[model samples]
Target: MNISIVLILLLAGAAFTFFAGNKFASKIALLVSVASFVFTLYALNLYLNGADLSCKSIWIQNPKIYFSLAVDGLSLAMLLLTTGLLPLIILSGWVTKFENEKAIYSLVLFMAFAMAGTFLAADGLLYYVFWELALIPIYFIALLWGNGSLEERKNAILKFFIYTFGGSLFMLVAFVYLYQKAGSLEIESLYALALTETEKTWLFLAFFLAYAIKIPLIPFHTWQANTYSKAPAIGTMLLSGIMLKMGLYSVLRWQLPITDTAAKEFMPYILGVSIAGVIYGAVLTLRQKNLKKLLAYSSLSHVGLIAAGLYSLTIEGFQGAVLQMLSHGLVIVGLFFVSEIIFNRWNTYTISEMGGIRSQATKFASFFMILVLASVAMPTTFNFVGEFTILYSLYNVNIGFAIVAGTTIILGAFYMLRMYQQTMLGETNTKVFADVTIVEGLVLLVIVVLVFFFGLYPKPIIELITPSLQNILNQIN
Candidate 1:
């Protein structure tokens, strides 16, 4: 195992700041997060060069517990998203005024460590550990920093925790069952163990339950809107941008191959659920008054489309799902961050409370409009590339499903344009609305460039993930 040591360095930096004073603490956290971001890039470079970074250490030998860390093309892509987004999240947190800056900064860094671990861990138990570890920091972040009724925020966090954790228990059972069969906790070992049809069926359901709740396919998604609305913007960014991808990634790493038969057998039903979610979420977005809730539903709708693509059970669908995952992550992070800007200046998130920012700040309105367009899958945006691929892939499966999925384009435009118009156009509500700050403009500009860059030329990412995607697709019976 050739260790990258980036994780080690990040954890070390976090540990060092345990006793640091308030003034320098945020600075320390910021520097460490930025460093981790650089190291993440380095890790990606290593992966691109075909260097393998797999390491394992025995943690609980009697129970066969082991700490395993590794990265592949898929995992590397997620790791890059996780690390790249952290610096921005950290910066966003910094721009906000917090009462306990030290604790807030420390908690954010800790959250970063947990997220990084989630992407890097290879052992089932280790992955679960990192998976649960992520919830703790975020729970606190929401409870302490969220702008909402205290009890309501607490309840939302508690509900979010309970729902996800409850699903994970079944996942734990599935892993234990696999351990009994494979005699090891390593993912690769478990992946190789042949299971009877019945066993695969039950294990797949267990895995599906966990991931479904997380990606939050309909009926299981009650916690998403409330949580996203109550939590701080950065918290919403983390949950939507990268954490939700945990489920999609698991579909590749665990579900497709291990439960190939079950997946194939139930493909239509899964696709149906996804389509329902897409429409349900979009229609609900049309009725939302809060900007955060609107974005939450929009994300739900987008994830549904990705899930539908994954269930298409073809190479095109699989690759499109992967691309969509990356595209969505980047787009949501930018959108939520921009929301933070709007909320900061206007001191409100309700669309009804905002009007006529277009004349006041053309630059701000323009950038927000770009993000809006990206969210709506406009041509020359990353979302367009992802959605096109998914639609094409769906066409291969069933033209009907593809046709249904295509409505998202129209639905998305309706809601996004409506959102922009309500918030940025019409009579000026206040005489004091200011343009985006320098830091804010830079952040928006960087995201906009990335949105168009990936949209115009996605071949590089598609090419990078091709080999691994084929490997996963081949495992599908």
Candidate 2:
């Protein structure tokens, strides 16, 4: 089967859902997303069996671009992450009474289509196109369906759009330069091109500017908290769960190997900045009384650690980053869904306003507690494997780096437990709190199951990604 089928299914699904009318939009979107997930699984199966699912053909004759899609363990991992979480993200919104429901669901499917393309595209220009395309649907998703006053939403969304878009222009410039020097925009072609130290450093910084802003590491993270706070639950999920991974994926896929010298040269400085983001985000998360903002900053902190691991440029770092990407994606979506459930019931995002829900909503509290533990890297959760590997990689680089970054685990446990305590463990609330509905319970159950499943047996994921990561390391060395 052509790997492009997954993208076609989602793009077509988006169109179909939009026209299907409001009555069936959510159901249709969910069905299509699940079907896309099934197709992705089939592709992964074929890939494991060595069926060669990649496709490439001419697109533009002048610029010498190709409509290319390639699969390897790294890209496949990302593809799986994009397709896998989408159904749950859609299903999480099943009970939401969104105005213009058809439009909302349609955009979700479209965003998935673009994110999948971003993962699969092998040609640099094509990858850049897919990367930018993923932004459009989410822009609308946040703007139209977002909470907060209209002015607040507008300002936040506009800032997010401008920051991300502006950063992408640097990436476009880098791609164009690569094409000029290499005479093709293909990944292998650029990878083969030899460049001077000066050239490689410039290229690395250009790509870093783009990915850093998208990853929103430290100084570049200004747009994140506001955007996450104001955007709708699913919009926030898409951003946290899948969108940010684009930047991280591009780092391993494009930046490191393509500019190996510069990556080695700047490793310490970059790692330092990343660890600083970990500290910065966790400290800021501690100060948030708003649930979404707290989660947003928490995501920022966790993502910084992922970025640090990837830039460490070790095999363990690469493996850990990929695993954590998947783990964090699932866990953050679950966390955001928990927040949405609370808001739906209590009509507020204020952490201080919540209390004693555990007394009434045992199922929800149970689910939320598991996610909370997972976020803090409890030993039995998938997060523990990823976090342990990442910190191990940093330790190899420098004990100080590991020690500083390790504080995130300590700080994360502190604040996350504190948030859970204030929100769920106080005296019984005056208002009634219902347990999770079947749909809500189902979504949380799936996430929790996957978290523990992967946590216990990460061998499959490790075996799947190892060879591909070794290949990237070879290029870097």
Candidate 3:
């Protein structure tokens, strides 16, 4: 598929710029990211027109794998999201003064390349490779450029790597066992395999382990807040915005359908824990005094609900899960960026020290308020669509599930609104606080526009994804 072109261009551009030196790296990365985004737009047009955009080439003969990258509406949506965010991520860091500017931009582009590849991969081995490839660049990005003491940053980033990588190993084992039994690595081929309920359960847990750590379900989530707190803003954006979605997307694409019988069997336990995460994360968010840590907990809370929607196995649930993924991706990027701007001015993350920022920077206050509202799933925001849909799906399963899960909105509002009022509304002792600069303003504006745009008109994605989701749903049954 032409979707592979995006990944190819990103990686090649990254390599070229790594040699292009600091003077040219950022420009090259931006242009390449723009080109990739344009190509995605062209591909999306073709896809909407019924063009054949799927491509597969034999890359391994023994144990059989393919350089198989396919983009139906589902894959294309993710590809578009990946490419769309790249230029913005690169541009977002334009003002940071780093020692190895070339390396920084290069790693950012490389991260995009890996993620785009993950979304496009249509073979198990190919997908696993792309999945692991994504972890390398971000690890260095956080380790070298991250804030906090070196020992602390190293411990946090290393824990993140080991925790996630360890889970991925189980996933690899599942894939290998699948390949051994099915004798092909094609995703569809593996999904079509008729396995016993017991076998399906094993595969389910294997895939779940990999996804849970990344999505960071309760006990599996210890690495996240620390990692987010320690990483640079750009690194945090990459983690919260795009990286978390990989697991959620995998749940939609691989885990559920492939383990359909087992998923049905374990639905209650899985769904229970996911819903529990919603409450757990929200309660912790209430206690957090660090700005970034609050955001970290907020992410866990939101994603927990999304995960519940996925396990609900209803059409509305899938719709909500996908829409919320996009919404959260856009919202978190702006939130983390907002944190960076605040830190740049105040040189502190302690929420107790921040007060009445709005009194000084009214423009920044307005932007921050809107993002905070979006994060809390306020009415008329993009998040509302997904959160409501997901909760409705939970209602389909059990009114109680929906009722319990719905507390996220209330708790989310309590924490986020309280934080916003404290940070931006009250009274700042500072003589003056700087407002958003041109680049920061542009970034927030783009995010705000998408929040309202999708909030008002999320149907395009529903239309695009329905056929693919229906196809998967059919297979599961």
Number of the top-ranking candidate, with TM-score as the measure: 2
Better of 1 and 2 by lDDT: 2
Q: In order, what lDDT does every prediction score?
A: 0.86, 0.95, 0.90
Ranking by lDDT: 2, 3, 1
Question: What clash count goes with each model?
Answer: 0, 0, 1
Summing lDDT over every window of 10 consecutive residues in candidate 2, give the lowest-scoring window.
71-80
- Comparing candidate 1 with candidate 3, which one achieves the higher lDDT? 3
Task: Summarize candidate 1's per-residue lDDT along 12-64 as a digit string, tens digits.
Answer: 76666556866777778778888887877777787788777877789887788
- Candidate 1 ranges with C-alpha deviation above 4 Å: 1-4
How does candidate 3 score on lDDT?
0.90
TM-score of every model?
0.97, 0.99, 0.98
Give the alpha carbon lDDT tens digit for every residue of 1-477 in model 2.
879999999999999999999999999999999999999899999999989999999999998899999988888888889989999999999858999999999999999999999999999989998999998998899999999988899999999999999999998999989988999999999999999999999999999999999998989999999999999999999999999999999999999999999999999999999999999999999999999999999999999999999999999999999999999999999999999999999999999899999999988999999999999999989999999999999999999999999999999999999999999998999988889999999999999999999999999999999999999999999
Clashing pairs in 3: 356-426
Each prediction's RMSD over C-alphas, in Å, is: 1.4, 0.6, 1.0
**Candidate 1 TM-score over all chains jointly:** 0.97
Sort the candidates on TM-score, descending order: 2, 3, 1
> Which ten contiguous residues of candidate 1 have the minimum total lDDT?
1-10
